[model samples]
Target: MPFVYMLQCADGSYYTGSTIDLERRLSEHQFGQGAVYTRDRRPVALVWHAEFDRIDEAFGWEKRIQGWSRAKKRLLIEGRYAELAGWSARQRACRERDG
Candidate 1:
């Protein structure tokens, strides 16, 4: 199985990734051997993860989640799916108002 995982870095930033071996990847991140973005933001903790039957699905989800705002991501981390639908409207309105 493959997994899409979200890690909360020590700096309070999030790192999203897909991997076949979640344990090894997480260990690497904690030991400063992961992505450059994560290497500097060491001591990361896995805050969320979803298992998928296909690696492609996991990778695709990882890519999709990486583009989300911190607030949206936090909703996922907190398992607040009910807010996600309304959040899209709010996010779009905010973008339109300020962008």
Candidate 2:
């Protein structure tokens, strides 16, 4: 199964990715053989992940999650799906109010 995963780096930043082999990908990231972003922020820990039927689906989810706010991602990582839409609504309102 392909998966979309999020890792919390040692610096407290998040890295999102999609891979068919979750364990191998994580190992690569740990050893600095993964994405440069993860390489720079080594000693990452897997925080959230969802299995998908296809690679493209996982990749699509990866891209979407990568664009989310830290707060939104936190909601996800914490398994608070009910609050996600509310957070998005709040964010949209903030953007519109600021502009």
Candidate 3:
């Protein structure tokens, strides 16, 4: 199965990616052998993950999650889909206020 995963970096930031082997990829990140983004922020924790039958689907989801705002991503990691709409509303308000 293909996997979409999120890691909490050592610096309290988040990273999202996908892989066919979650365990191996995670190991790589922890050991500073993975993506450069995660390499500098080693000792990451696997905060979220989802499995899919197709690699393409997993990759698509990875891209989607990577594009999310931090609040939206946190809602997803916490399994709080219902709260996302409220968060999105707040984001829109903030953006409107800023500009």
Question: What lDDT score belongs to each candidate, Candidate 1 first?
Answer: 0.93, 0.93, 0.92
Alpha-carbon lDDT of model 3:
0.92
Give me the displacement of residue 60 in model 3, in angstroms. 0.5
Residues 18-38, candidate 1: write the lDDT tens digits.
999999999999999999999
Where does candidate 3 stray beyond 4 Å? 86-91, 94-99
lDDT of 2 by residue, 1-99 (tens): 999999999999999999999999999999999999998898999999999998999999999998889999999999999888857757789978999
RMSD score of candidate 2 (Å): 2.8
Question: TM-scores, in order shown?
Answer: 0.88, 0.89, 0.87
Query: Considering summed lDDT, which 10 consecutive residues are worst modelled in model 3?
Result: 81-90
Screening candidate 2 with a backbone cut-off below 3 angstroms (N, C-alpha, C), the clashing residue pairs are none
The runs of at least 3 residues in candidate 2 whose Cα sits more than 4 Å from the true structure, single-residue gaps closed, are 89-99
CA lDDT for candidate 1: 0.93
> What tens digits encode model 3's per-residue C-alpha lDDT throughout 9-96?
9999999999999999999998899999999998899999999999999999999888888989999999997877746656789978
